[model samples]
Target: MSPCCNWMWGLSRRLVLSGRCQLSARHNVDVHRSFSSVPHPPRVCVVGSGPAGFYTAQHLLKHHTEVLVDIYEKLPVPFGLVRFGVAPDHPEVKNVINTFTQTAQSERCGFFGNVTIGNDVTVEELQAAYHAVVLSYGAEDKRELGIPGEDLPGVYAARDFVGWYNGLPYNRHLNPDLSSDTAIILGQGNVALDVARILLSPIELLKKTDITQCALDALIQSHVRRVLLIGRRGPLQVAFTIKELREMLHLPGTRPRLDPNDYQGLGDITKDLPRPRKRLTELLVKSALEEPTEKDATRWSVAEREWSLRFFRSPIEILPSKDGNKAAGVRLSVTRIEGTGDNSIAVPTGQVEDVSGGLVLSSIGYKSIPISQAVPFLPKQGVIPNSMGRVKESPGLYCSGWVKRGPVGVITTTMSDGFETAQAILEDMKSGNLNCSESRPGAAAIQKLLSLKQIQPISFSDWEKIDAVETARGLEIGKPREKILDPQEMLSVVSN
Candidate 1:
């Protein structure tokens, strides 16, 4: 129902839950059903179902029993990226899902799986439905390279590619041609490493994991072995944590190569290197001293390549030779660094370059799109306009998660953001900011919009039924279950 296009888990959901109910008759006028002394709890509506939303709900439920919280998600599944964004091999990261599942199944909290405010539902309607609303929908689109040929069929945003390989339901149609002999990645973040590792992993290695059947099939037919991770900035700017970089180094068959060229202009290179880099460089130095003809220590058979991170080169154009319609290489404009480029974001522009590759991946970043009609957005920041998670322009509105902050920090940061937003809501409630005097509209109006063919929204039980089938499926594959990819299949999963 949300206007955002389907990506990882397609943002949208619908809820038809009725907790407070009453049967009306001609003379049934004893309608006041409880003691007047009991405090009328302020209701909270959480606008996302990701970790931020779930954690906030969990914290609120744990502390405040009187508050009734309703969680709204655009997706049919509840855990957002925790279910669709995590790597298949990293089952430990996936462990967080269990905690979220428990939190989602709360008595005080209601889960509205398939709904979208601003589109199927609206900010005005939400203002009428609950006392306070929290927006936690994560970033929805890929941050761009803003270079030419990005729209080429072979070129994929790292977010989309990673989503595909991870078996995220929203990206099933994305069958990236891993058949390219050489693949070039454009960033040095943790996400870039994930894409590289998965792209290089043997299909057999991925079989036991929770890779979607489609992704599994694609990996089996892949032809890529060489991955060149390109970063315009120096190695020091790489966003990957030491832990992930180390893990990449330790992948038994994955021989992570460090290009010494990245250190050429980084004065006093030994001191500039972070501990992770120093350690990685040490490993490379140790390996270089060995016989070039000598094989790796293990029999996993890692093919070696002279891949390196080239700094100060910006992509100018994507060139495709007559391998007819398929990309031949990428042409980059090399820029000269003229200052203390170390830790400086201002890149000097004046040089030019070109590098040939069989495939290209743009790992720029991700963007959070405000829903249709959810106005007052920050064009530069790509976030819904808000003050510390408080949606100021609209009353009874708030935002959290990636939608609150841009697509940058980790899940834990989102948790902190959610809690802070909830606290803000509580404070607002205490000050009598939650006045539902002139009722804007009810959930029935939202349903009326649906009946008028505005858009289809998914429901909570619909998600539960989906969860059941997917869990059973995961048991069948010896990995965690995955939701059905197509919208029809997902709807059918519950109906049949």
Candidate 2:
């Protein structure tokens, strides 16, 4: 371990030995008695067992030596988006799950899976049971395009598509039609690129990953040859980072369909842009200007798929087929950038273009939904209303991650948000703002309530059983792990 980790471990050990911790308002355990006599320590309840929740628990446990944390997850499994939202090919990002598992294994920590906050337990119940309640449930709802024919058969949200391939239980039945020769994605973000990559990637390469067998089978039969990524802004305003773009450009048996005209004047402004934007724009310009090399030409000769970035185009409607039942193409309004830099806005030019495509995936973004009436949610912003991490007008109620801020940022960003929220809770405790006089029974009390309701919550050990079954099933098929895409099957795995 590193010196910092050693110090933290030593500090935790010392705190436990001293037994100078005070019970929170919810923790009814008598602090005056010996640590062994107190059945419950100062406890915190974190909703949602995602990265944000685990990170928050980690920080709280690290700083408050005697605190007990119970994480509640709606799914029988854990690692939320890391398991269900991240691209299957990006396995390195999933390595953080190891750290989360270590946190869950902590003596002071507990995991309660298959517990929905709104249905299984209310916010009021959790607040009454724990000293602090941290809401880390991430944004699960996808933003809609609100265009005509958006609800057509061939239209799909990028969120559902991602969940479908990643084996999320909710999207297991999303059997998207892949018989189209062309696909249109209505965003220029990394998700759009991921969707495109999955559509065009070789079946042999996909078969090696943890992608759902059903999704893999669909791709094997896919007739999609071209993918067009439509963005409402200029090339410089594309939301995708350089790494994903680079991967798409170098994908075997595929080539980028970039237009030189789109990158004509970007070279002169590249130097003045921010480092990330500068690098991304430079790469885009280079790719647009460079001619296919001999090797690339040879590869292009056999290329079976291609993807292009369409800038300054906003979808007005999803044009329906002659039968008026399924999406046949997209009608786009031409747009021009006004002003410059990040502040530039796309203004429609009153010119319309029709692009034919059999399938359309809207990758706009994600939005947070109100978990319950208790949470002070700002529906307009799709986030919880809060000052720092504390929810407005709700004492001991906190929020973190996408729900606290907005649906944006990566894992590192959520981790930092979790740490900040943990710090705020610690500060409040130190300031006596979080009264610990009233004894809160914590998880023991909550478990009793669950038992009374006949709801069997899945423990961390239980999740391990499910995990084992998944791994063994995957081994049989020569892939990573075949996920249990049904909640009932997941529960059955644990029960058996």
Alpha-carbon lDDT, every model:
0.66, 0.86
| Candidate 1 RMSD to the correct structure | 5.6
For this target, which candidate reaches the highest TM-score against the unseen true structure? 2
What is the Cα-based TM-score of model 1? Answer: 0.83
TM-score of each: 0.83, 0.91
lDDT of 2 by residue, 1-496 (tens): 2458435433432333222112122222221224433454577999998889999999998998778789999777999999998899888899999999999988788888877788668999999988999999999899999988899999999999999999987788989999899999999998999999999998888888899899999998999999999999998898889999988988888988899999998899999999999999999998898787788778877898999999999999999999998999999999999988879999999999999998999999999899899888899899999988999999999999999999887899999999999999999988989876567878767766765555666678878988999889989998889888877667656655
- Residue 74, candidate 1: C-alpha displacement in angstroms: 2.0
Candidate 1, residues 5-36: lDDT per residue as tens digits?
53322322221222111211210221122332
How much is the lDDT of residue 91 in candidate 2? 84
List runs of model 2 lying over 4 Å from the truth. Answer: 1-40
- Report the Cα lDDT for residue 333, model 2: 96
